[model samples]
Target: MAEQVTLYTNPMSRGRIVRWMLEEIGQPYKTEWLAYGPQMKSADFTAINPLGKVPAIRHGATVVTETPAILAYLADAFPQAGLAPAPADRGNYYRWLFFTSGPVESAVISQACGFTVPDDRRPMVGFVDMQRMMDIIASAITANPYVAGDAFSAADIYIASHLSFSTRVGSVGSRPVFADYIARMTDRDAFRRASAIDDEARAAQASKG
Candidate 1:
């Protein structure tokens, strides 16, 4: 029997990505929606996540937070889902997974906020800056069809998600590789279903506001 998965999330948050991942896993799970502000700050939600963040999941007694961590956990927890690469081919998997969740995300957010990290402080930042991160990513994707390799894996789901969001927000430039990668990811049925769920949730939340 499958374990019960209860996902605590917000429609407008990174929870969208986790929802998509859940769809790919093809498992039944429950979603608890939280409106940002007081709802997210509420003790009910904060008890599950000390930071009071969404995108946290409880698989039976196991509690996992952070989008990337949740995705990684799902891959291992549901081995039958086939979201992970074979043990021998996991190097690229870990590579792009952490890079996207860490450096690439930082660079995009920093640029979005109109902040720049000087060269002297580059060592402190994993990606250094937006341009450098783009250059590195362009080269990586150009070399491989997917983040992990030829076949789609959890890494592709994660990195492509960041690229998709960055594209929508005008943070990532109009590189053909980025566009093509996002196009492939967004076209999946899992992506469509997960996004539709969030869209409805977002609309309902807005109506109450």
Candidate 2:
């Protein structure tokens, strides 16, 4: 028997990404919905994630946090799902995965929050040039159907999710390549199931207010 997996998440957070990955892995996992603020900061929750963040997962005795880390962990835990490239072929997989978690995430959040990096300090920031960053992403997505390479992998999930959110929030300028990539990556059964579950949860949460 497989070890039980539990997802601690809020419907509206990046937990949705983990939801999608879980669906793709076809694993039976339990979802514990947490409201922001009090519920998330509660001691019980903090014991699982010291940062009081949603989107942490418990698989048997292991605890995994951080969106990208969770995705990578699930892919490795369920290799039959083929969400990760073979170990020797993970150069681009690890590259784009951490790239999205680092530079892409940093740039989008900073831009959306109206924070600007000083021109002199551009070198210090990983995603200093917005245009250049988007161009690089576009090149990668357009170069192949997937981010890592010819095969769809966990990297695609993180990349597509980030681009979808960034474009929707106006943090990143809309581009045909981005839209195309998101559409292709999300037009899967797993993605649809995950989105529907989250949408329903989101509606239910809103109705409670």
Candidate 3:
């Protein structure tokens, strides 16, 4: 039986990444937009995700949270999408995908807040510092066309979303590699369609007030 996928999200939240991924994968999904504050904390929605976060997915009877996990799950479930890397390429695939969610995101958030790991724990940190993480990511793209090598997979969606979000939030400076990556990802028809729909929805809500 084909799985039924439903996404609960808000456009302004991290859920946007999942939204883009859904569009890229061309899966049919039902979206429930939750407003902030009391609406998101409502009992009905809270049951699905105790954390009251957006981007939760109901696939059949299973509920999945966390952006990276959702991305990985969708890719595997829909093999026809060609988003998952083959078992042979699992090493690079998992490395870049998890790196974006783990170190790269952590480093960006920490740097934005002007925080750093204690000197003694620096080596234990996945990303010693934002600059180092940025340098490594930039070098990877310059060295290889894609995050997990030549093939574009779900890893690209995750990495591209992070790079795009980082650049937009000023966490990442305007570098050529960042600029190039964003340009390429945004140029995709799927991305453009999702972005346009989100923009329209936001505009409609604004005009109602």
On lDDT, the candidate that comes out on top is 2
Candidate order by TM-score, highest to lowest? 2, 1, 3
Q: Which pairs, if any, clash in model 1?
A: none
lDDT of 2 by residue, 56-134 (tens): 9999999999999999999999999999999999999999899889998888788778898988898888885788889
Q: Number of clashes in every candidate structure?
A: 0, 0, 0
Per-residue alpha-carbon lDDT of candidate 1 for residues 167-190, written as tens digits (9 for 90 to 100): 888998878889987888678899
RMSD of each: 1.4, 1.0, 1.6
Q: Relative to the unseen true structure, what is the C-alpha lDDT of residue 11 in candidate 3, on a scale of 0 to 100?
A: 75
* Over 4 Å off, model 3: none
**Candidate 1 vs. truth: CA RMSD?**
1.4
Output candidate 2 Cα RMSD: 1.0
The sequence of per-residue lDDT tens digits that candidate 3 reaches over residues 85-191 is 78788787788889888989888888888886789988888775677788888877666777777777778888888888888878888788888987876678878
Off by over 4 Å in 2: none
TM-score of 1: 0.94
Worst 10 residues of 2 by lDDT: 140-149
Q: What are the models' TM-scores?
A: 0.94, 0.97, 0.93
